[model samples]
Target: MSTNVLPLSKPVPADSSLRLVPDVPDFVVGPGLSPEVADVVTLIGGSATAGRNLAETRRIFTQVRRALGPTVPDIASIREEVINTPAGKLNLRLYRPSFGFRPLPALLFFHGGGWTVGDLDSHDTLCRQLAIATGHVIVAVDYRLAPENPWPAPIEDGWEALRWLSNYAPLLAIDPLAIGVAGDSAGGNIAAVLALKARDEGGPALKGQVLIYPCTDLSASLPSHFAHADGYLLTRKQYLAYVANYLAGQDVEQDWRVSPLRAARFDGLPPTVIITAGFDPLLDEGRAYAGRLAAAGVPVIHRSYADMVHGFITMGGRLPAANRAIADIGRALASHDIYAFSDGGGI
Candidate 1:
């Protein structure tokens, strides 16, 4: 991770296939990425697994995130709760931006760390931001990680969390009718699967989904995955390592649960906002998922930060675009009918 900045150049052409919704005035798509993001990338460097094992990797991942991530914003309230699932106890943190008594729409959020790292604390700042930005109760789930709890465990926890949140909405001052799902990286993968599950299995109806540089395809065969595999923070090697750990020798890359983009149908899923970083390896799949959602008659908002890299959303401390992207997400959530709550004090 050299401090030397890459020479700036003309921005790459925007993907013609992606149809970005122009409703959000503040959420501008990229002609160029923030130079500050590039500086952060240099400061953070490649993967957390370069010379460390799973435990060390996990610790370092959280450490780096906290170091470079955004400052925690003040909120009206934040509370933690425990729920039992098939995999055992799961932890959820709820963030509220105001003390209003009105029942609010909620977003069930999962953190990104390739499913091997990240927890409530790792994503606390982002969740808080969403709470302020979207004017929704942000429920951040501490899903089980990989290697120790691979494949279905994380998604299993997510499903249970979604059901738990919806079933117990009133108690939490949340509107059961306005629930949605969101996550970044591996967590994004889970959110997408949960949206599909809510559609196929029925119950806990979802209003929308916001996937931030989500890993919609675990196969890692997409062209963007290769094109930006190295140099960027999320390298090809690190990504494959995370995939291997999550799979744990299981041959389920094609499974819809493992890879939402591999799902047979996308027609009935909720409205979606897919945010992709131009330099991220997962860029193509995120864009592909957005395209598929649009083609299937689902409302879709696809925005590509042409100059940003993978994991920029969490780097709000150093990246202005990161904060802007989050605000855009808030606008997207608010666009859904169920999310038409009071303006409150949201971003």
Candidate 2:
């Protein structure tokens, strides 16, 4: 580990309010962040979504995610399928584990790119790894992206995919009863919403939900939004831009469907595994969401990677913790005995 402390510079876009370390005079690098990630941060500099319009931002994001993503591991089998929804054709990729039993438990994964950029290919490697680690089938949903198919469109696609998967579980040898939802970032937001929706609809009961550094609150007023906003890969400017693009000029920040943290109740939701990054902007809200779920009597397991940042889960190639986190998430998804664990706070 490098004992070297990098100096902080003013954030790009001339935003004086954005602080790398809130209320702290001296800004040091790798406070708790691993040296591997810190070196990558220095190499990458700032957000790829910075200073670009929607089209360019999307292109850059796609490129960066692919280039920095972990090495793809070979899985048992991968097949593509399409579900015809009222909105349109929703594409999905199913990954079967090499060693899981017949009718294996499955996880429906949503890719993260703020809801604007990512697609099936962006998260292909991660899903493959998840399937292998958990010994469960992994269904990767290639939902519609934003600024094109904005709010509720991705959700609609996600919900329809779940329904379709449940209805046709036998076709793919999936255990309908053992189905769960998992996603990172914006996809995490969708997974959280879908868990609630499934509970309310009273069918297709989910086994669990894995939320990886999810942006639970669109309000974006949490303290972490400013505390670790600038130096990390995900900048505040980019975060708001993603939200705006998803909203598509609509004022729906308070909508529970858009922000699951705003939901009136969290009870009866599936057992949840919430992964939070200490240096990510969404840290506070992710913790708050876990607390809310626990308070409502839902079984929740909250894991905080105190040295990581937002979107670190996708950069497993550059950071060893990301790969370890993926395996940890796999155990959470695979375990049926997860309710035995506490939410750490005993809330």
Candidate 3:
């Protein structure tokens, strides 16, 4: 809520564990794509086609993501529950890793769909994989989508879910002090906002955050937005449409919750890991956010997959980079000392 934007600084060096694929030449439409991803994109028409109404757009995206066949890890258990919130009941899917103790660290995950299309089922595979790789409890929040729920509604649901996890840690078999947030795209926006809210409200201290290709700046004028706006899984038109649907006539471009990069201060945030794909329209903002966080003295690790496109994380079944990225995320979480073990537990 501070109006004073944090001063920008020189780029932070990439984390040692961060991998950078070589950049492809400008002549290429989607440079450096793995064969699997390239084939998938080619089959689906590299960019989201324009002129579809909201319903049609949602249907197309849903079908396309379903076709990706995300990798499903063999977790110990999965359960469904709902968190009671002031606004309404929000659905949640809980995932337990195959090899972790009762009081394990937990991640409250939000899935990406431009905040319109994704659901618990859409991201089921990714959540399971994360639970297994990180050895942490994964709570996938099916937050309300935009144009219907819109703006503060999704944000509110995210906060409520995080609070519920922290408050009911014992019932959930999680360590309250070891919980964090993770999300991709629109979901990433929610996770970032939750981190800000927690810092301001002074409770539910988070261990860390993992934001994958997050839409950090809703204003959306970054260089990458123009440079890689087309021929990537997520296109410029789609990006604008998603924002318009999400904003629903309210003007909150300057609001920190909507645009965390515009926030006045970034201090006191948890340690963080931010991942950005080279061909993602959201790439520059994600990188800028990492720089801002580092400038404010928050411990930050930034990983850039220079050869990939946005939404690659959800294509792990085909993209080796996606699986590798998941593994890197696990290592980052563990290195932060967020995971916990009971007396008889083993890694």
What's the TM-score of each model vs. the native? 0.87, 0.85, 0.86
lDDT of 2 by residue, 1-347 (tens): 11111122111222323322213223234355666667656545443544556676666555555556666676677888877999878888888766433577778999998898887776777788788887778898999988788998989999999999889887777776778899999999999999989988996778788898998999899999998777776778779988987999888889888999999999999888999998999999899999999999988888899888888887776777888987887676545353222321100
lDDT of 1 by residue, 1-347 (tens): 11111121222122333211112222222223455654555455644544556676676666666655566677777787889887788988888777665787788999999888988777777888888988888899999988798988998899999999989988988888888899999989999999999999986788888899999889999999888876677888889989988999999999999999998989988888889999899999998999889899998888788888999887776677899999988777656444544532122
For residues 1-347, write the lDDT of model 3, one tens digit per residue.
Answer: 11111111222122322212222234134666666556555555522454556676666565555545453455677877776899878888888875434577788999998887788766777787788888878899989988898898889999999989999987767778788899999999999999999999997888889999998999999999998776676778778988988999899988999998988899999989889998789999999999999999998888899878888887765567888888889887767554434422222
Off by over 4 Å in 2: 1-32, 50-55, 99-101, 334-347
Candidate 3 error regions (>4 Å): 1-35, 46-50, 53-56, 99-101, 340-347
Q: After superposition, how far is residue 335 of candidate 3 from its true place, in Å?
A: 2.1
The lowest-lDDT stretch of 10 consecutive residues in candidate 2 is: 1-10
**Top candidate, metric TM-score:** 1
Candidate order, lDDT descending: 1, 3, 2
Question: Candidate 1: TM-score?
Answer: 0.87
The stretch of ten residues in a row with the least summed lDDT in candidate 3 is: 1-10
TM-score of 2: 0.85
What's the CA RMSD of model 3 in angstroms?
Answer: 10.3
Worst 10 residues of 1 by lDDT: 1-10
Off by over 4 Å in 1: 1-35, 336-338, 341-347
Rank by TM-score, highest first: 1, 3, 2
| Model 1 vs truth, CA RMSD | 10.3
